[model samples]
Target chain A: MFLQQIINGLTVGGVYALIALGYTMVYGILELINFAHGEIYMIGAYLGIIFLGIFTTAGLTQYSLPLSLFLTVVLSVLFCSAYGFTVEKLAYKPLRNAPRLNPLISAIGVSIFLQNYVMLTQGATDKVFPHVLPVTTIEFSGITMTSLQIIIIVVSLLLMAGLHLFIMKTRTGKAMRAVAQDKVMASLLGIDIDRIISVTFIIGSGLAAVAGLMVAMYYGLVNYSIGYIAGIKAFTAAVLGGIGSVPGAMIGGFVLGLIESLGAGYLSSEYKDAYAFIVLILILMVKPTGLLGKSEGHKP
Target chain B: MLKLENIHTSYGHIEAVRGTNLEIRKGEIVSLIGSNGAGKSTTLMTISGILRPVKGKVIFEGREIQGLSPHKIVSMGVSQVPEGRRIFPKLTVRENLEMGAYLKGKGQRAKGKGSGVKGQEARGKGEDTSRGDSRIALAEQLDHIFNLFPVLKERQKQLGGTLSGGEQQMLAIGRALMSGPELLLLDEPSLGLAPIIVIKIFKTIRELNAGGLTILLVEQNAKAALRLAHRGYVIESGRVTREGIGKELLDDPAIKRAYLGE
Candidate 1:
């Protein structure tokens, strides 16, 4: 039972890390905590369900698993990218030159708006996600693992690896980093700061959508409320890893996952969320900038 | 090569540049010298497209660039090293230079001509959508900047934020040069630097102008700016008060008393 719970924790935590990356990346660049990002994740799952419904109605279920997953991911990415772009243009861009607090409030407003909008459209009821993958279990050393768990882990890792490479090597990736460092300077040097920022949102929201789809598959159901807890936990992971650090979010997610799992196994299962929060508090108290965050000194 | 015609710019309700006119011809260093708050920086910002003018036009290389975006102005080959050495502090010195050559490389790649490991990628992407070429051009331009500022070559891997003040100024200039612009707009290049570093920077500016780079400089240090410039403009309260040859302005009694601190 303990081993099974560990696997479960790892699977869920992997998805949380994926979602957390978007938050960390956006915050890293703009210093804007996009409260609406989790709702973007929720929307991704909803998009997947909508696509699946359309495909099933069209009788495309006979397609191979790989092709189906590819279609799901492509459609989800397109939807999420468009959604992220719209969110930025409407909610964030207008308030860009305004006071920082204005945009922060706007982000929260967007979050609430998206949540309620989904609730209104989807009737506030939990929608059951159809099983898209085989549920075969593989046992090793008295530990049982589901095929879905393996798929989630592998897919998340691959996506993370791809993201890491893109940030480190690609031209647009470099532009994003340049803008994050200094928007005015980047503009002076001929970088389109606004375009890079939009691309950042696109990448971040796309990742969130992928995480949403994976989580929906893993849990077999989703609701408008799904984004809230998952969003909080993912945010905690981001903070734990260092809010602006990409690799930090990944490490933070795994550590939080393990802590929650072990706490559930050795202590009370009801205390799992509490345990994660307690660890977060401890981490913050010890290092407010986060585990991997550097304290930047401003020149007076 | 560049002209600001009766341009008016403001910050919120406060008018910073009120009907200011300025010009910089090809192969000349034209300095705008004034006291702080006299709209010198505001004028530069307006030309750089960071601040759009409330009224008037900016003609550069015979093209009207008024109301254009900053990035678009850059694409038109007018590069500004803004006030305060706003280097991308988190990026390496090398990466900072690469950004300058973004559009040039993009153009080169669009033409489908270059030789290097990265050139193939650029050629394949083509001119209309060749991010790869722009990247390669940026790398090549970095090498040119490294040669121009050898210290930067030594500290190529160092983060822009970690550079010393003098080094940061050099990096800012070098970053702008990477774009290979026909015209360079410099805003207060000597602010907060030691006398020795300021002299070195001014000397470099003179050398760059002599090498056929048209320059429009804004400076608070009137004496130093006038010494290096061929022509000078004196602005006060957001308008041009006087314009003359650099030596004539330096010798003017009113200019000496007010700006040159006789």
Candidate 2:
């Protein structure tokens, strides 16, 4: 039973990490909390459902589950990346040099705008995500494993590993880190600051899109208003991990997911959401920089 | 290779570079010597396209480049090693140098054609063996940089912030050179260094100038700067007060008294 709960927590936490990465990366680069990040994920979920609906109406899902799923993920990722890029260009780029508070407020405004835009277009009601993924079961001894949970965990881990490798072993990745450290210096080295920032948004949003699709597959529903609370939860995860550290954000999400799951199971389901905020406050009080916070004391 | 004609750059209302004009001929080393607030660094900033001249024209290779972005200017073979040695502190020595050859790595940053947008294609650096020529050229530049600062090569794995001040300065200059710049703008290369290390840096600059690199050096260390350059300009209150050949300015009694502290 305990192991089953851990698997459940990890499945949910993996999704949280995906969404949290978008927030953490933007914050790492620009020091903006990117309140609109949650909306981007929300939009990703909508895009996923819309694509799935298209596949269903076209009678494609009946032919091949793998083909339908592939198309849905590809279309959703591409559209979400574009949306993330446009958002940065229109909403955030103009305020690059403005005082810190101005951009933070602008980010909040963007979040609200995206939320309402979706609510108006998609309607306020929860949209059903068809149970496309097969519900096969793998059992060992007394424990049973759902194929969907396995798929979610495996896919999220793969994406995270890919992101880590890209960041550590690529030229553009090095340039992005250089920009994050010193924008002026990066530009002086012939790095296009604007282009790098756009790429950062794209990568973050792409990850969020995958998370959105996974959640839709898992929960089988998505609403426009889903972004607000999830955004807050993912943000808490980012803050819990360390706002600017990539690995920190990943770790934070997993840890937060476990805590929330365990808390609900052991304590009270009513206060499950409260646990994230409580942990966030405790982390802020104990280690304000978050777990694995980028150490300023360490030279370079 | 570079000319600034009647340039005026400002910070909001207060002008930092007031009606300053400067020039650096091809393969010649020029120094702009001034005290703090004399606009030497500001002049370099304007030339590097970090700041646009509110008035007057900046021509590099006979093209107006005053309002172009810094990265654009760099690709035009104009690179600046800014004040305080602004090396990315969190990156490793090798990573820092790799960032230096950023334009060289892609060969499109200089042409303003490459972008970080299609970054999904930025696959692993392992496949970089495809661009054999550029890769070899980058290796040669790395050898050159390593030759210039053996300490950097020795501590290639060390974090940039962990390096001593003098080592950081060398890394800064080495990083700038990786771009294969035609006109290198150096701001305060000798700031806050041991006098002995300052001499070594100046000697390296002299050697670089001799090997056919045009340099516009900004310095508060007036004595060392004027000593290395072929020609020198003196600025005070954002205006060029005097311009002369290097030795002539060094020997000038007033300059000796005011700057060299003779």
Give me the candidate number with maximum lDDT: 2
Question: For each candidate, how many residue pairs have backbone atoms clashing (under 3 Å)?
Answer: 1, 0
What is the TM-score of candidate 1?
0.91
Q: Give candidates' CA RMSD values in order.
A: 4.9, 5.3
DockQ list for all candidates: 0.62, 0.74
Model 2: which residue pairs collide? none
Residue A43 of candidate 1: its Cα lDDT?
A: 94
Q: Where does model 1 sit among the CAPRI classes?
A: medium
Off by over 4 Å in 2: A295-300, B109-132
- Estimated TM-score per prediction? 0.91, 0.94
Find the 10 residues in a row with the least total lDDT in model 2 chain B: B112-121
Mark the regions of model 1 whose C-alpha exceeds 4 Å error after superposition. Answer: A1-6, A280-286, A297-300, B108-136
Best candidate according to TM-score: 2
Candidate 2 per-residue lDDT over residues A76-117, each given as its tens digit: 999999999999999899999899898899889999999999
